[model samples]
Target: MKKVIIVGAVGGGATAASQLRYYDKEMEITVYDRDTTMSYAACGTPYVIGGVIEEESSIIMATPEQFQDKRNIDVLLEHEIIEIRRSQKQVLVRNLATGKEFTDSYDALILSPGGSAIMPEIDGMDGHVFSLRSYADMQAIQSFIAREKPSHCVVSGAGFIGLEMAENLSHLGLEVAIVHKSASILSILDEDLSKILQKELLSHGIDVYTDAVIDKINGNTLHLSNGKKLESDLVIMSIGLKPNTSLAEQAGLSIGVTGGIQTNDFMQTDDPFIYAIGDATENDDFITGDPKRVPLAVPAHRQAFIAARHITGNPIAKKGLLGTSILKVFDLDAAMTGLTETQIKEKGLLAKTVVHIGNSNAGYYPDHSKLTLKVHYNPETRQLLGAQCIGGKGVDKRIDVLATAIYGGLTIDDLQALELCYAPPFSSPKDPVNMIGYKAIE
Candidate 1:
């Protein structure tokens, strides 16, 4: 006879709602989302824009009716929960469709407001700027591309989203330019490996501009802080995202240093009955044990399951995150996990980094590309702190292995002992992961 209320309906919120049904069949659960739609995969958005996904509906995983009939969870799309009253164990929900407000009481509440894309404040950027955060945002980009048929495009930022968008936009035969303020693109990849990635971007006919920032936008032209002018048909801003903690903050919840909701190991906020998950909550970093905001769908979903278990009297501690991520640009793929060398140095910790260059398969194999693997380890402990891999194939596989090692608290030497599969078309006898350990010893 317990009722659970969830805010937001994507990623963590939706996952928790569905899992709660399997855990406690009789638990009353209701989900409210500001977006007038059910849960959809946001990660496939760039592919949606690139025409790789012909239908936007293809990305939508579940509809409200599906959840209602099968899971028995009430889904109220466009019903935004504007306020949370901890004392009353209820939230003020606004029917965005009808402009009516009502209170929904709950025995337990979970907040997963997710993240908002950063929009740069600049002159003359009123309509020319677009960001990909929601399904609507992705649809807007596709519509613009289809209607305008823009020949030249300027992308601001060179992170994962920016790089992926750049590749997708370029694949549509549009001339693409990326303007990043940082010294290198893909900052998560260490400087050395990132340089190689920048080379790949350039080889794909995508112009790369480093040490450049947008001062303002005049029509379709961008005035750069580094004294360069870029004219484009449209602009995409993939700068980054911050935790969407506005609602949680207004509810008198404590915000963490990472600009996310502060929660304990049980994902419980100051109020025990209320929990925070997804990008809106800070994660304990595996390497440093610091509160880190990892706006990733995997960690968000995992946290939601753990939080739901705790609410059902099956409390389990939420472990730290490694910040594992991956992206594909043209024929090349990149994936990384844990801390980077720059991050380690920023924390005043000495990291021993080893870059292993090996083939995805044996050198005699027909389809082979040189895979660049960069691993960061503690100088004294030799524990794996982080890793970055860039190649045409096997990049994702190796990063996941290293990510697991980091999660398992494995050291550089531990990678050498891993019995990875080896074959002509797959991996070399001395796999790059094993080579990483062999190099670290030297």
Candidate 2:
């Protein structure tokens, strides 16, 4: 029997384990994770903090027994891979609970050790400040909030997690101030599109400072480079994520320009016997075919499936990602798929973009919400490249459609004439997606 050892049994590793079992039941599969058993919806950690989710146990999707009994996969929880001996096809692991160490052999290896929150070298960062990266991270934050009961909070960084912490902290009735190094929130979005988000933040009474850098974070005070200091009760760092890649690197795996493990479409690393997937792998943008770091859940899960199939010799052809992502700020929903105009320009792609404001449903329909759709397409070929939507309702669906269109290599003409289900309460004769496609052609 072929022994396949998978490191880090979260989304990518866990999915890979199940997929491998489905393909070949007789294969020996062992999954290792430093954390607890198979957990799901780790991305929903923010919602859990905001009281949107009731319990931490709710996020867990599978237990070790379930994987063992159902899939015949051994899930070794709290077993961390400390060293990777690629030449020997073995890994040195340590049991966190007992402080015992051992080496495990594998015919095939899968690395999905995931990423961690960027903890900068600030002096007081370790003293106080939490990042909502893992289940334990969120638990610490939750305990801190409950124990400290801080009246005012400061969130550093305005990316997804930063903004999410900002909104959730504010919802907890705390005064929240966001200090961002970038010029605006959602720095990936175009300047104009970001302005819309800035206005929303202000409307929620959240103080947002752009072009601000934190020199040091002292007790309840953040020292800024702009000759200003802000006081808060607590500090939350949502700066960014650094891919967990030391294991692959020490094992002599090829690391990509993006500082992630280099992998092909099949998620196979330089060593065919070993594979890398999820946030740790260097992914390409389907539209531009350039190395991109898309650390979303869908991509992670998709990469796992791809890697599993390749290991089982049943590979599926995947064109890569369109960077599809969605976030909710209070009542507002923001989603984007494919490439943004900013990304298009960055990639030096000859692209044209159009923005239109439409109602989520019929104009006369009650509770109609405004939807702003931005579509980007190749000017020469009129091929859809990417899109972004911001609104209260139906934003997620529109982004989903755009994501599928980009995956299918659909053109603007195809998008414009596409048939979609519509109802008076749900959509219009011309869906926002088709309308954006029609406008992009103009």
Candidate 3:
């Protein structure tokens, strides 16, 4: 009976424990988490803040009691792993509730410490400043909104989380303004698509200020480096996320250039007995095969499966990551997978991009929506490298198709022969995806 100790019991940790139990029912598994809540939908926190979810409990997938009862695994909440003793294969744990310290020895150890929100150093950023990363963070923001009845909000950073928070905050009847440090909102997309989104933001009564940073905060006023002053009742700092790799670093594990713990295809660190996964671990990029950190939930779950299978003597090599991601912006859906053209250029890769602007479905169909699609491929080899799509409908479907194509090693010309579903209200005879493929050849 091997004893396994897992630190952090959210997405990756929870999935690993369940998958491990499924393979070997006799192994002893003990999971520890510093936060009180575990196995909750961290991605849905923004919608819950906007009253779209209605209740916090709706996002919780499982409770500690449920895991213990159903899987016969021990899940200890409010218990933090203070130190890792690699020599003895043990972890120093502290009961945050009781302030008592204990030692837990393990045959194998797993680290899934996730990540932390990057809060910049600014003067007077003491009050009403929030960053949504966990369930508690979401609760804090919701409580602040209900208590303060804030009428204006200033959101810093224009990434996925930043844009989502802006829209949700606006949904609560607040005058939302986005102040991004970059030249455009949603840096995942190119400047052309970003400009299109900026127009949509302006049309929805949201103020946009690019190439700006918050200099200082004075009570309810925010001073911008762009020489603009804004009186905001609330402030959201979604600058970025940094992987919580201090524990792994302290344990003498290698950290990759992406600031995540270095792991092999088996999610194992230099220490064969210790494994790391989730946002804290760096894996190979699916397209470029370079070290990359993907903080998305889907990749975390997949990595967990690989780690668990390896531990159970049923090893499966990881297939790498594409960093596929998507988000909703007002009436439009923005999605991307693999690398952007800018990224390709940065890597000094010779790539060609093809863009197609067409209807989501047949033009004659009622309520047909427009879609802008872009695909990048290697000009020499004709291999698909990446893709981006923005549209009112069928955006998710098309992005999924493109992501699958890239995963299957499909070439730019291969998309044209894809037999995608077509109907009057669903899609055109030659779908936007097919059009992009045809255009790529031209």
lDDT of each: 0.90, 0.85, 0.93
Candidate number with greatest TM-score: 3
Compared with the true structure, what per-residue lDDT tens digits does model 1 show for residues 47-134? 8898788888988989899999999999999999999988999999999989999999999999989999999788888766898889
Predicted candidate 3 versus true structure: per-residue lDDT over 347-428, tens digit per residue: 9998999999999999988878999999999988999999999889899999899999999989999999999999999999
Q: Could you tell me how far off, in angstroms, the CA of residue 31 lies in candidate 2 after the best superposition?
A: 1.0
- Which candidate, 1 or 3, has the higher TM-score? 3
Error of 3 at 134 (Å): 0.9
In candidate 2, how many Å is residue 67 off? 1.7
Clashing pairs in 3: none
lDDT of 3 at 370: 91
Model 2, 117-209: lDDT tens digits are: 897778666545777788888888899889988988888899989888889888889899888988878876667777878788889989988
Q: What is the TM-score of each candidate against the true structure?
A: 0.98, 0.97, 0.99
Q: 99, model 3: CA deviation in Å?
A: 1.1
Top candidate when judged by lDDT against the true structure:
3
Question: What range of 10 consecutive residues in model 1 has the weakest lDDT sum?
Answer: 120-129
